[model samples]
Target: MVVFFDSLQGVLVILVMIVIGYILARSRWFSPSSSQIIARIVTQIALPMYMIDTITKDFTKQQLAQLLPNLKYPVISMMILFGLSVAIARLLHVRKNRRGLFQSMFFNSNTVFVGLPINMALFGPSSLPYVLVYYMANTTFFWTLGTYLIQRDGEGTWKFDIFTTLKKVFSPPLFGFMIGVVLVLLDVKIPTFIASDLHYMGALTIPLSMIFIGIAIEKAGLRNIKLSRYSLGVLAGRFILAPILMSLLLWRADVPQLMKQVFILQSAMPVMTNAPVVAKLYGADADYAAIMVTESTILSLIAVPILMTLLQK
Candidate 1:
C-alpha cells in the first residue's frame, strides 16, 4: 500500500508538471519555437550536466565496476525489444511515414524525463547507478539503431551509412556518461565549485523536459489526438507488449529486485519526448512522432501507476 501511494504520488507530480506546461502553452505564454529552444537546452546542456553530476556525486569506481557485469541485461533487452518493435510495426502495417516513429517509440523511452524521477521516488537515490546503466543502453540504441530506423523510414530508403550512424551513436549525452565513468575510474577530483555549478545547471532537466512535453501536447492539440489504428497499435506495443516482454526477459535474471523493477518501469514509460525532434531532424514524420509522444505521455498517467502497482505485487 505504501509502494502504491508512492508510485501514485510520483505519477501525479509528473502529470501536474506536464499540465503546467500545457496551460502555459495553451495560454500563449510559451510559443512553439520556445519548445525548440527548451529542447536544445535540455538535450545539449542540462541533460549532459545532469548525467555528470548524478554519476560523479553518487557513484564510485567499485560500484560502477559491480554494475558492469549486469549491464548486459539492459543492452540485450533493448536490442531484443527493438527487433520485436520492427516486427510489430510491419505486422500492423503502420504507414511508411510513421513506421520509424512507431518502432522508435517502442524501444526508446523517456528514460531521463520520466524514468529518472520515478525511479528516485520509488526506489530512492541509490538506484541512480542502475538507472545510469539503463541510460547507457537506451542512449546506445537510440543514437545508432534508433536513428537509423527513423532516417530510413523518413527517407523511404535503405541507404546505409556507417560513418553517419557511428557519428550519431556518440552523442553529447553519451559523452557525458563516458566522461563521468572515466572520472570515477581515474579518481579525478572535480573541484567543489564545478560540481555545484553542474548540479545547478543539471537541475533544469526534469522541469524543462516536462514543460517541453506540455508544449508538444498543446501543439498537437488535445482534441486531435484520437485513437487511430496506428496510434492504438503503437500505444499497445508501448504500454502493454513492451512491459510484458521486458518482465519475461528479466524474470530469470539474477539482479536486485529494485533493478528489475526499475528496468520494467522504464520499459513501460511513455515514448521518448525527443522522438519528434529526431523525426523532424531526420525528415521522418514529425507530426506523427509528436502525436505519439504526447498521446503516450498523457496515457502514461494512468498506465504507469497501474503497471508499477502490479509490479509491486
Candidate 2:
C-alpha cells in the first residue's frame, strides 16, 4: 500500500508541475511569445547543460557495458513500431500527407526535454548511466533513421546532404555525450563545485520543458483539431501498446531489469516536438504533426502514470 502510494505521489508531483505550466499559459499570465522565448533558453542552454552534467558524472566502462546494449534496443523497437504505424495508417486509407504527418509525429518523441524529466523523476540519479546510454543511441537513430523517415515521403531525399545530416546528428546533446566519453576514457575528475553548478542548471529541465509543452498545447488548441475514435486509438497505440511490445521484446533479449524499465518509460513519452519542425521543413502536414504533438503530450500525462505502474512492476 505504501509503495503504491509513494509511486502515485511521485507521479502526481510531475503532473502538478505540468498543471502549473498549463494554468500559467491558459490564464494568460505568460503570453505565447514569452513562452517561446523561455523555451529557446531551456532547449538550447539548460537542456545541454543538464545533458553535460548528467553524462559526466560516474560514467565508467563497466557501466557502459551494462547500458549500451539496451541503448539501441529501445530505438530499434521504436522504428519497428513506427513502421507498423505507417502501415496501419495506409490500411486505414489515410491521405498521403496526413499519413506522413502521423508517421513522423507518432514515431518521434520529446526525448530530451520531456523524457529526461520523467525518467529522472521515476528512477533518480542512479538512472543517469542508462539515460546517457539511451541518449547516445536515440540521438544517432534520430539523425539517421528519423531523418530518413521524415524525408522519405517528402521533398528531401535520403541522399540529400548526408554530411549536413551527420552534422545535425552531432548536435549539442551528442556533443555533451562525446565530452562524457572523453572524461570516462581519460579518467579525468571534475571538482565538486563545478559538478554542483552544472547540477543546478540541469535542475531547470523539467519546469522549463513543461512550460514549453504548455505553450505548444496553447498553440495547438484542443478545439482547433478534431479527434476521432481511430485517431484516439493510434494515440493509445503510441503511448501504451508500443511500450508494452518493447518491454516484452527487451525482456526476451535479456536486457537488465532497470534498463528495461527505462526503455519502456522512454517509449511511453509523447511525440517529439521536433516532428512538427521537420514536417514543416519537408512541406508535409506540419499543422497535423503539431496537433499530434500536442494531443499525444496531453494524453501521455495520463498514459505515462499507467505505464509506470505497469512497466515498473
Candidate 3:
C-alpha cells in the first residue's frame, strides 16, 4: 500500500506540472513556439547539465567500479527490449511512418523526466547509482538504434549513412554521461560553484519537460484523443508487456532488492515525453507520438501504482 501511494504521488506531481502547462497554453502565456523553445532548452542545456550533475553527485570511484560489472544487465536487457519492441511493431503491422514511433513508445521511456524523480521518491537517494546504470543503457540505445528506428520509419527509407548514424549516437546527453563517468573514474572534483550552477540548471529538466508535454497535449486537443488500436497496442507495450518482460528478465538476476525494483519500475514508465520532439525533428508522425505520450502519461497514474504494488510482493 505504501509503495502504491508513493508511486501515485510521484506520478501525480508530474501530472500537475502538465496541467499547469495546459492552463498556461490555453491562456496564451505558453504557445506552441514556446513549447518548442523549452524543448530546445531541455535537450540542449538542461538535460545535459542534469545528467552531469546527477551522475557525478551520486557516484564515486568504488561505487562506479562495482557498478561496471553489472552494467551488462541493463545493456543486455535493453537490447532484448528493443528486439521485442521491433518484433511487436512488425506483428501489429504498424504503418511505416509510425513504426519508429511505435518502437520508441514500446521500448524507450521518459527516464530523465519521469523515471529519475520517481526512483528518488520511491527508493530514496540510495537508488541513484542503479538509476544511473539504467540511464547509461537507456540513453545510449535511445540515441543510437532507437534514433535509427524512428528516422527510418519516419522517412520510409533504408539509406544508411555511417557518419550520420555515428553522429546521432554521440548526442549531447551521451556526451555529458561520458564526461561525468570520466570525472568519476579520475576522482576529479568539479568546482563547488560550477557544480552548484549545473545543479540549478539541471533542476529545470523535469518541470520544463512536463510543461512541454502539456503543450503537446494542448496542441493535440484533449477531445481529439481517440485510442486507436495502435494506441491501445502502445499502451499495452509500455504498461503491460514491458513490466512483465522486465520482471521475467530480472527475477533471477543476482543483484540487490532495490536494484531489481528500480529496473522494473523504470520499465513501467510512461512513454518518453521526447517522443513527439524526436518525431517532429526526424519527420515522423509527431501527432501520433504526441497522442501516445499524453495518453500513456495519464494512464500511468493507475498503471505505475498497481505495478509497484505487485512488484513489491
Best candidate (score: lDDT): 1
For model 2, residues 264-284, the per-residue Cα lDDT tens digits are 777777777877777778776
As for lDDT, the candidate ahead, 1 or 3, is 1
Candidate 2 clash pair list: 108-272, 109-272, 110-272
In candidate 1, clashing pairs total: 0
The 0-to-1 C-alpha lDDT of every candidate, in the order given, reads: 0.81, 0.70, 0.78
The pairs that clash in candidate 3 are none
The TM-score obtained by model 3 is: 0.87
* TM-score (all chains, Cα) for each model: 0.90, 0.87, 0.87
Candidate 2 Cα deviation (angstroms), residue 147: 3.6
Deviation from native of the Cα of residue 56 in model 2, angstroms:
3.5
| lDDT, candidate 1, 66-170, per-residue tens | 886777877777778778877888888888777877887887887777787667766776787777778777877887777778887675555667787666667
> Which wins on TM-score, candidate 1 or candidate 3?
1
Could you tell me which 10 consecutive residues in candidate 1 have the lowest summed lDDT? 153-162
Best-fitting candidate, scored by TM-score? 1
Deviation from native of the Cα of residue 273 in model 2, angstroms: 0.8
- Residue-wise lDDT of candidate 3 within 50-145, one digit each (tens)? 778988888777766777676677677777777887788778888877887788778887776677767776777678667767777777677677
Model 3 spans with C-alpha error above 4 angstroms:
90-97, 281-283
